[model samples]
Target: MMKRFLILSALISLSIFSSDKIGRLPVYKIAVEAVPATEEGIVLRDFIKEQIQSTSRGTISLPLKESESGNWEFDKEGNPTLETVANIKRYTDTDKLVLISTEDGQAVISFVDVLHRKLEYRNSLPDSLSKTLVSDFLGFLDKKNIYLALSETGSGSNAQLKINSLKPTYVAGEPIRFEIESAEDNYVYVVLVPENQKGEPILLFPNQIQNDNFVRKGDRVTIPDKRISFKASSVPSKDRIRAFASREEWKEFQLRGKKEDSFYRLLPPAVTGTKTTARSMTVVPNTLTASIEQSPVMEWEYQILSR
Candidate 1:
């Protein structure tokens, strides 16, 4: 009888862990309203409601509430606020509200922790009519691909392998997000190379014979179009790994956000001189030979923020 009980407990534990992992946290309560009442505004309000109700399930809890008036204002840091986000539990009663407003070709979303009086995430979207906006937002919480340069010891083999990049698109003032999976058996090293010069790949090894402290187990890597997520346990430190992108350029990244249509979308990076699209890239084989460096993996989904 004890053995059976133990077996059941193990099974339950495994099942819980195996469930669809919700990549985003619930917002608890969300108050949405369109700017400039019109035929379009009413339709938009209903669309936003449906999207919020469906997409933010495991990510955020957006309870429905009614408010008379609200406005968008920022603090000294120029961060926007969502009038009364603190008491979201009682969001329905108070006149104070958390506001999300949309205008001609732009949309601004903000949230405030009214109780703590702190600001959370806020973003602006360009003119788009995509319905799967929430999916894009939720997708942002998922892991992204990042590019890494690795070099071999004596083989003179230099190559770049695409990894994952971070989400929310780092702003110029924001710090680089480089969280790794674990740190027990690995280290991350980074050498910034010149922009115009073609350089060798960075090295990352498993065994700790090399004095490479640049790459720690939990250290993160970012790419132009993706994010490479790693835990301390899975990091490789022996291989010489380096990056060549500028600190300023590193700030730009693909954004994920909720759409008025109720689906999520991937906002591609701003178009520049170079036309880089993840969709055009071909898929790389998963399992590769250790001797030969592996190719970068590409995803063929919605890189566009709108429909």
Candidate 2:
């Protein structure tokens, strides 16, 4: 029986090859089991299941199976050992498994990839677990599987933005200078995402301090432009700067100010087009609007490592 199953699995793998290659793979039957039976564990299990189903988009099917008692066997570090792997394979008749466990008030989610014989993803949960983190994890998985489509196109010949920092790395208290150049008249949006600070995105452009998100074509915008200087955060962390340029003004989202700083209070969720991943910058050929026939949008990202 075991030999027959293995032969069948190999044959199926050879026969299936969908345009979305991941979709062609056999359905991964995953058993989600928690250790010590905690409420958090149960919640996390359900959340993972939902995220997998949502992100897969019928590409990678993860059919859930009832986990038996003592199904989750892992080492002290929350990794499956050889013995545990054998047991899981024997009991589930498959290798993929999600083990959720809490240690020292930190939840650890491990996705064991049996075919690769490695832990695909392992992360310590934050104090407040949000859907963003799940999306990030799912994105990580998609990237690992070479499933993300990072393609961009449109009439962006006149729309271009260049970003440059004074230094590649900076100290906590030092001031960082940025120089931006635009090829055409465009409205720009700049956002800084700090690794140390999760879920708190910093709006650099279009703020009260620098109220000019608009720039003329062939103009260069300099940060700390004689009037203002941008200082580094007190906390030591890595950060990423994303700059977006568009021919048409973005009316879909609104930025609100609180006290001295402005933030994106209501940003519309990005719509996923066919052959494109959500949150990815994809160009739509025809918006069918008067002011915007072909809304050309361009984006650039840069990493900043701070200590």
Candidate 3:
């Protein structure tokens, strides 16, 4: 059996792995994110940034994007979510993502290394922000020196993710119907944010009924488009819809909620995207792959507030 890869982002062409882009390397931008995004988290985020830069003596470049909202929300599983990542991408331009999360004065961090396809360097804050992480980061670059070369190729140059129609507000229990279209064939993933105060983001597409997520271009899609015994969800509890449109297959997402239940939950992505199609509240991939970051993606979101 093959090992499962995380559904972080679309894989760029394998050729970039062939050579380090004509013998060139970039300083590489690293973005630091805090889980929970509290004042302490923000403080820790800043502290770690300063410490790393100072400790590295200069090779590691971690630029705090002014566009960052510093709101690192997580799924119920206490993991950083894809929605958060997509939001970051929508707001900032970063080559690598570093997630720092702490509790009870203890901290842990994960760095997304696309070249190795692995998450690197996890230790406590202030103390662990040592030269080891920087050395490893720089060492990988110096050795493999794989930069995301995305100039000559693009997955869907003609594709666009758009909302065809959606009501600003709907009466509780009313049929939720909306329109979304893409100019080219694409794999569209959608998640629903529930109205509950402690609710997690749920995977709305690739559900039990509508298992096929590949949509043809030029045809407007009515979501929940499964051709079986189903219609729109009338839960009236969900208020937000986040959609991701990309031209490549994501890694794989694992199931969260138990089967034989009313709904299945996909806790989602252990560095891989989900494929089970189970209806579960899950997180999207925060650390995307180089190919995905280099390629075109549509992250469309809308929320209907309760009156």
Give the candidate number with the greatest TM-score: 2
Q: What is the lDDT of residue 193 in candidate 1?
A: 18
In model 2, the clashing pairs are none
Error of 2 at 186 (Å): 1.3
Where does the lowest 10-residue lDDT sum fall in candidate 2?
5-14
- Which segments of model 2 are wrong by more than 4 Å? 1-63, 67-159, 196-200, 224-229, 262-266, 269-307
As a whole number from 0 to 100, the lDDT of residue 108 in candidate 3 is: 56
Order the candidate numbers by TM-score, best to worst: 2, 3, 1
Q: What is the TM-score of each candidate against the true structure?
A: 0.30, 0.41, 0.38
Better of 1 and 2 by TM-score: 2
Tens-place lDDT per residue, model 1, 190-288, is 332112212222222211233223333344433211221211111111111232211122223232222321111122241221223332111111111
Tell me which of candidates 2 and 3 scores higher on lDDT: 2
Residue 51 of model 2, lDDT score: 55
The global C-alpha lDDT for each of the candidates, from Candidate 1 onward, is 0.29, 0.46, 0.43
Task: Please list the Cα RMSD from the true structure of every candidate, rounded to 1 decimal place.
Answer: 19.1, 15.4, 14.6
Best candidate (score: lDDT): 2
